[model samples]
Target chain A: MFSPLIEDLIRALRCLPGVGPKSAQRMAMYLLEKDRDAAGLLASSLQQAVEKVGRCSRCRTLTEQDVCSLCHNPRRDHTLLCVVETPADVLAIEQAGNYHGLYFVLHGHLSPIDGVGPADLGLDLLGERLGEQVEQGISELIIATNPTVEGEATAQFIAERARAKGVAVSRIAHGVPIGGELEYIDGGTLAHAFNSRTVL
Target chain B: MFSPLIEDLIRALRCLPGVGPKSAQRMAMYLLEKDRDAAGLLASSLQQAVEKVGRCSRCRTLTEQDVCSLCHNPRRDHTLLCVVETPADVLAIEQAGNYHGLYFVLHGHLSPIDGVGPADLGLDLLGERLGEQVEQGISELIIATNPTVEGEATAQFIAERARAKGVAVSRIAHGVPIGGELEYIDGGTLAHAFNSRTVL
Candidate 1:
C-alpha cells in the first residue's frame, strides 16, 4: 500500500525479535513522518554495530572490542566465573547488581535435537580455561543456566569437566522468586522451592 | 553494561515506536547474534528510505518518485478524493480494498496550540486544486480523518472549504466496528452507532 522504499523499510523492521507487521508499519511511518534525524542515527548505528560487533574472545559475549569490558575489568573477582546461556543473561545479572565475579556466556545450552553440542558452545575453550585455572585464578564455576532439561544436562556436563580439573562447580538455586505469592506460583517452581529449602 | 557500539545500537533502537529499553536490547542481541545479514539489510534499507523518500507532489504521501503511484494511476477515479491525516491512514484504507479514488494526506490535523495552521497542512494547495476542480475533474471530497476532537474539527474545516468551492463533501461514518459487541463497545462508540443507525 506504501511506496517501494517505505515497504522495504517496514519489511526490514520485522527482523527485530518481537516486532510484527503492524508494529513494523507504525515504526516505519513514525520514523519517516516524525523523526528523520532519529531514523538516520538508528541506521548509522545499526550499520556500524553490524560491521564491528563480534564475540568477545574471553567471555563469548557480544562486543566490538576483542575482550569485553566485563571480562577485562580487574576489580571483578576472576576466581568466580558464572556460566550462562546467552549474552542477554550477562546484562540481566549485571542489572540485578549482586554478582561481582566474571561471566562465561555459553550462547546456548546443549540441545541435541537441533544439533547444538559442546563444540558449538565453545566448551573446548572453557575446558582450556578450566585447565589453566591456577594461572587464570579461576577456582569456582557457577552454573547459572536456565533450569530446563537442556540447561540441567549442560550444567552436569560442565560440572564434570570442572571437577576433573580440580575446580569446584556450583549451580545457582532455583525456587520461587522473592515477594512472589505461593498460590500464584507454578507447581514446578513451588516443588523446587520446597525441595531446595535452606535453613536460616 | 554493554560495549560502546552495542550500547549505541541499543540506544538507537529505542527510537522505534513502542520499543523500550528491554525490547531494544533483545532486538539488538537477536540481530547481532542470530542474523547479521538481516541487520545489515535493515540498516541499508532505513538509510536509503530516509535519504530518498519524500512527499508526493500531488497527494503529499511518502514516495521516492516525484508523484506517488496511486496519484499517477490513470484508472483511479479522479472525480473523488479522500483526505486523510497521514500516509498510514491511506495504507489502512487501501488495505480495506474498497476505495478506488485518490488521496490527499494532511500530514497532521490543525492544532492552534501546536501552531499547525491551514498553510502548514498545504491547505492552500488543496484550495487551488478545489478551485480548478472543473479542469481536474474532481466533484466529490471525502473526509476520512480519524474520529477524535481534532480529527472532527479538521474534517469539518475541510468540509466547509470544499463546500465553498462548490464541491460535494462527506465525512466517513463513525460507528461501532463490524465485529464489535455492543456490550463490550465503549459508550462514545455506542452513542455514535445509535446516532448513525441505517434503514437496513
Candidate 2:
C-alpha cells in the first residue's frame, strides 16, 4: 500500500493497544505529512524510555531509577503496601490521589490456564518483604489486583502467606463506580455492592 | 506523573491522532512492561520514516523516492488524474481499488481563516502539471476533495483553473453512501443523492 519504510512504520505502530491496520496507516501518514517533528521526538523518547526505564526495585512499577518516586517519597506510608497486578493499575490508584501508601506490583495475576504462577509474579519476593515488614511494625497489605478469578485467587494466596508472617491483609472493595446508575450495573457488581454494604 | 523519560514519551505520543493523555500513558506503560522489543522497533521505524519519507515531487503524496510509486507505475492511466486534499485521502482511494488513474495530492484544502491559500496547497505546481499533462494527452482532472465548504471552494477553484488550461474537469459526486439507508442519511446528502440520481 505504501513504501516499505512507511509500511514498516504502520505495522510497528500496531504494537499500541486498540490500533488496527487502518488506524496505523492514518497515524503513519499523519506523521509523515504534518507532524514529522513530533514523530522524531516520539521516536527518540520511545527509544530513551526503552533504554532507560525498568521496574522499580522495591515495587516493580516501571521507572527510570532503581526505586520509583513514590517508593522514595518519605511522605508516603511505607507501613501500608498496596499490591496490584500491573504498573498501569498503580498509575490509576496514584491518579485517584486518595492513596498515600507505597505499592508492590505483582506484574500479573496467577492464571493457571496461562501457566502464570506465584513464582512467575515474584510472590517469593513479596513474601520476603512481608516477613521483613512485620519486624518493622507494618500494619496492612492491601490487595488491589483486578477483581477477576485469577486476581481473587492471587489475593487469597497472598493473604494466607502474609497472615503466616503476622501482617494484616485486606482486599480493595468491589462495587459499582461512584457515579454509576444501579439499573445499568452488571449483576456481579450489584451483588458485590450488596454483599459489601457498610453502616451509614 | 512518572519519570521524565516516561513523561516525555507519553507527551510525545499524544501527537498521534485520537490518542489522549490517558491512552498515551497506557501505551507507554504497555511498551515498557511487556513489549520492549516491539517498542524499540517502533521507535527506530518512526525515525527511519521521518528521515526517509518525503513528498513525491510530482503528486505531493508521501514517498521515499522522488516520485510516488503510483506516479511511476506505467500500468496506471496517466491521462486521468484524481486530485485530493491529503495523503490519507489517497490511501482511502487506493484501498477502494476502483480508481486506476494516478493522483495529485494537494496536502490541504484552502482555508482562509487558517491562512491557507492556493499557493499553500501548491496549486501553482498543480497548474504546471495540468498544463504539461494536457500536451501529453491527459484529458480529465477529477476533483476528489472532501465535501466541506472549504473543500468545495478549493475544488471549484482548481476546476476553473484547469478548464482555463483547456483540460476537462469533473467533481466527484456528493451523495449518500452505497449501503446507507436514506432515513439514516443526512438531509444534505439525501438532497444531493436526489439531484444526482442516475437512470437505471
Candidate 3:
C-alpha cells in the first residue's frame, strides 16, 4: 500500500506485461522516490516510440518510417533475409551481430486457433517481394523461429510456402544455449536433435 | 528478440524495480502487440505522474502538493502520529485501513553498512515533529517499520526517542501471513516466531 497517488500510479503501471500486483507497487514506489528522472524519461520514450515508430512497408520490421533502418542500410545484405515472428525477435537477433542480412517481421504466427492463416501473414505480398528480390540475386532465407512448438510449426509453414515460390529456405539450428549445462538440460531427444542439425 | 521500438521500450521498462531482463522484454513486446491501447494509457499516466507528483515537504511522502494527502487531511488525528521508513510502508498501513492518523515518511532505515544513520534518515526532524505532536496532545506514536532487522532497529530507536519525550509508543505485530502454510516453512522456528508475536 502507498499513498492514493502512488497507488494510482502503480495501478497504472500494472498495464505492463508480467508486472503483477506486487511488482507494480514496487515500481511505483521506486519511481516516486529512487529514480524519478529515469521513470519520467521512460514515460516519454513510451509515447514517442508508439507515435513515431511503425512498420517497414516491404519487410514489416518496425521503423520510424515506411522503411526501417535495416531496409534502408546499404551495407546489410538485402539478398539474405531473416524472417522472424515478432519485432522483438528481430532485435534479439540483431543484438548478437552475427547476421548482416535484412529482416522481415511477420508480426504474428499462423495460429488457426486465432483464425490467422498464411494470407493473414501477407505471404502473397511476401512472394511478390521475393520475386522482386530475385532480380537482386537473392539466395538464402533464414527461418529463425524460437524452439517452441508453435515456433516450429510456424517455421515449417513459412518454409513450405517460401519454397513453393522457388526460394531456398533454411532454419537456424535449435540446440542447447551456449552456456547451458546438461544437468539442467531436458536433453532427452533434443540431444539427438542438436546432433542432427541439417539444412532443409 | 523484438523490433527496435519494442526493444527500446523494454529497455526503458527496466527502470522499474523488480523488473529484470526477461520480464521487461516480455512487457515491451506485450505493450506493442497485444495491448497498444493500454500501453498508450500507461505512457500517459507515467508522464502525468512524473510531471505532477512531488514529495510532501514535511514528510517526504509522495503527493501532488508540497504536503502529502495525510499531512493535509484535517480529519486525520494530527496528535496521533505514525512513523514509517518509506512511502511504501505508509501505503501498507493505510491499506490495513484501521489507523486514522497523520504519517511521517523517513524514506529509509538506518543501515550503517550502507552509511545510513540518524541524519541520513532525517531522524532529527522526526524527533522535532514527535515533540510537536506531544505538545498538541498527540499522546500516541505508532512505530510501524517493516519486520526486517533494520526496520526493527529503526522502530526501537524511534520508540526510545518518543518515550523520552513522554509519548506512548506501539509497534505493529508480525506473525504468519493470512494464507500461510506451515509445512513448507523453513526452520522449525517459524512457528516460534508465530507464537512470539509481540505488542509494542
Candidate 4:
C-alpha cells in the first residue's frame, strides 16, 4: 500500500501549469520507482517558487531579487522599454534572441470585468518612470501588451499618459490577430511587428 | 545573455518522460525565475538515480538492493511466483490490489528478431528457481506475461521448462484483443480474465 505522503506529493505535483491526472500519476510512479530525486526536485521547486518569486520593485517582473536582471543590466537600453503582460511573455521574447530593450512586466492585462485597473498594476510607477524622462534621458516606450480589447485599452491609456509627459510612445504593429498573444505568435511575425511598430 | 549551462540544464530537464520543448522551456524559466532550489534538487536526483537503481540481483526487478521487496517479503508465497514482462507491469498488478503474489521481472518480452532468448533474460536462474521447488515447498507458478504473440511464446516456454520440474504451472488468462494492455483494460474484464484462466 502507498503512503498518504506519496498521495499528497502527487496532488501537489498536479498543480503544475499543465500537468493532468494521468501525467501526475505517471510522474508519481516514476518518482516512487525510478526517480525519487526528480520528484523531490519538483516538490522543492514548487515550494521555493511559491515562497520566493515575486514582482520586482522596479519593473513588476517576477524576480527573486529586488530588481530583475533586465532592469538592472546597464548594457540594456533603459531609454527604450518594451512592456509585456506576464513573466511568461518575457521568456517567449528572450527565446527569440532579438529584443535588446528593457522589459516591464505588467503581470496582468487590464480587465475591467476582472476588476483590474491602472492602479491595480504598477501603472502609477510606470507613469512616474516615464515622467522622469529628462533626468533618466529616456526616448521611446513600446507598448507590447497583447492585442485583446483589454490589452488595447491598457496600451491606449499608457500611450496617452506617456504622450502627456512629452515622450514618444508606440504600440507593437498588429499582424498576428486582435485577440492573440505574442507568445503563441510566430517569431518572424513578432520580428516584423517589432520592425514596423507605429506611433500610438 | 544565457549560458550553455542554462541550455544544458534545459536539455537535461527535457529528458523527463513526456516533457516537450515548450514544457522544457517553461521548466527552465521556472527554475531561473523562482525555483533554483528545485533545479538543484532535480540535478542531484538525476545524478543520484543515474548512479544507482539497478536490477535486483535475485529477480531482475528494478531495485537499489540485491533482492527486491516482493522477493524478500516473508509473507509473500515464494512458491507461487508470478512472472511479468516489466517492472511497470508489476506496479500495474499491485495497483489492482488483488494479487498478493511475488514477482520475477523479465525486463522485456521475447523477440526472436531482437535476439532475446531464455538465457539472455536470466531464465537460467529462473530454471534453477523452478528446479528447487520440491525442496523449497513451492506449489504453483503463474505465467502473467502479456497476451501478445511474443508474450504467449515466452509464457509457453517458461511453463514447459517449469512444469518439467514437476510443479503445477498455469498461463495467465486472455480474453482481450490484440495489442491491449491490462492497465487500460476495464476492471470487469481483468477480473473475468483472472477468474476464468484456462490451463495451457
- Which of candidates 2 and 3 is the stronger one according to TM-score? 2
TM-score of 1: 0.94
Tens digits of per-residue lDDT for model 2 on B36-79? Answer: 99999999999999999988999988888898899889899999
| DockQ category of candidate 3 | acceptable
Count clashes in each candidate, considering only residues at least 3 apart in sequence or on different chains: 0, 0, 10, 0
Docking class for candidate 2: medium
Q: Best by TM-score, which number? A: 1
Candidate 3 Cα outliers beyond 4 Å, as residue runs: A1-4, A92-99, A133-135, A146-157, A172-200, B1-10, B56-60, B65-79, B95-101, B110-136, B146-164, B170-200
lDDT of each: 0.92, 0.89, 0.78, 0.71
Candidate 1 lDDT by residue in tens digits, B1-200: 89999999999999999999989999999999899999999999999999999999889999999999998999999888999999989989999999999999999999999999998888987887777746566788999999999999999999999999899999899898888788899999988889999998
lDDT of 4 by residue, A33-65 (tens): 556555545444434554566667878876656
Worst 10 residues of 4 chain A by lDDT: A1-10
**Cα lDDT tens digits for candidate 1, A34-94:** 9999999999999999999989998899999999999899899888899999999998899
Point out the worst 10-residue segment of candidate 2 chain B by lDDT: B130-139
Model 1: residues with Cα > 4 Å off, grouped in runs: A133-136, B133-136, B190-200
Sort by lDDT, best first: what order?
1, 2, 3, 4
